[model samples]
Target: MSIVETVTADMKTAMKARDKQTLSVIRMLKAALMNEKVKVNHELTDEEAQAVIAREYKQRKESLDEFQKGNREDLVTETQAELKVVEKYMPKQLSQAEIEKIVATTIAEVGATGTSDFGKVMGAVMPKVKGKADGKLVNQAVKSQLS
Candidate 1:
């Protein structure tokens, strides 16, 4: 099934289970997906759906950080719960070691020797690692390999 269909089914399940947190998060995701579809006037492919989920995950991470810094433990807990729900739809994350291996191989493939060639290496690497690895981790791995 498409992501939209899966999400709809999950939403129904959440509602029936009285899982308010999961239901709310799923509704938010649905809205974001719908907005993207409306924006482009086309249904999103699986990749596009993954992109939306990733974006939402990133937002939740930021909120978690901000809440922690502001000493709002309640908000932090809430955001963490929301993040957990959002993550249920994400692709399995790559381990740091796995990411490092790919980054090293990508660097060699692109002949990236120093910081000057960072962009060249990144342009070639990001697509290969997309959705599976976090961008910050990839950037750090690339920097370590290049430096």
Candidate 2:
């Protein structure tokens, strides 16, 4: 089944199990997917559906970070739980070493040298890593490799 179908199935499972937290997260995802479908006026491809989930996961990560910075333990705990639920649908993330290797190769391919070529390197790297890696870590990997 497609990711969207999987999300629907999981939503039903969450309901049957009375998993409130998971149910809510899945419902939010379903809403987002519904919005995207309305916006595009068609069913979403698995990639497009996954892109939406990745966007949701990114939002959760950002909120989790902000909550920690504000010293809101309760919010942090809640966002962390939400993140775990969202993460079930994300692609396996690339490790630091893996990101670094990709950055190195992209730099070579693009002939990027030093910090000045930062944009060139990043432009080449982001698409290769895309939903498989976090942007901040990928940025750091690219910077460290360049400098």
Candidate 3:
């Protein structure tokens, strides 16, 4: 089934199981997906759905970090739970090694000899990594490789 359908099905399962946290996260994701669809005036492809989920995942991670820094353990735990629920819909994340390999190949392909070509290298690499890796990690890898 498609990610949207899977999310919907899981929402029902969460409701049935009385999983409040999971249900909330699933509802939030569904709303985000619906908003994206409405904005584009069409049904989303799997890649688009993944993009939406990735955005949600990114938000959760950011919140988790902030909560940790502030010593808000309760919020941190809640955001972590939400992140786990959202991550079920995302692609398997690439490891540091995998991202490094792809970044190296992309830099070579784009003829990016230094940080001067960061944009060119990033444009070429982002699509390849997309939902599979975090942008910050990819950027760090590219910078390390270029320098």
Which structure among the candidates has the greatest lDDT?
Answer: 2
Q: Write the per-residue lDDT of candidate 1 for residues 70-132, one digit (tens) a residue.
A: 999999999999998888889999999999999899888988889999999989989998888
lDDT of each: 0.92, 0.95, 0.93
lDDT of 3 by residue, 10-56 (tens): 99999999999899989999999999999999999988999999999
TM-score of each: 0.97, 0.97, 0.97
Say what the RMSD of model 3 is. Answer: 0.9
TM-score of 2: 0.97
Among all windows of 10 consecutive residues in model 1, the one with the lowest summed lDDT is 104-113
After TM-score superposition, the amount by which residue 7's alpha carbon in candidate 3 deviates from its true location, in angstroms, is: 0.4
Candidate 2 lDDT over 1-147, as tens digits, reads 999999999999999999999999999999999999999999999989989999999999999999999999999999999999999999999999999999999999999989999999999999999899999999999889999
**Of models 1 and 2, which has the larger lDDT?**
2
Number of colliding residue pairs in each model = 0, 0, 0
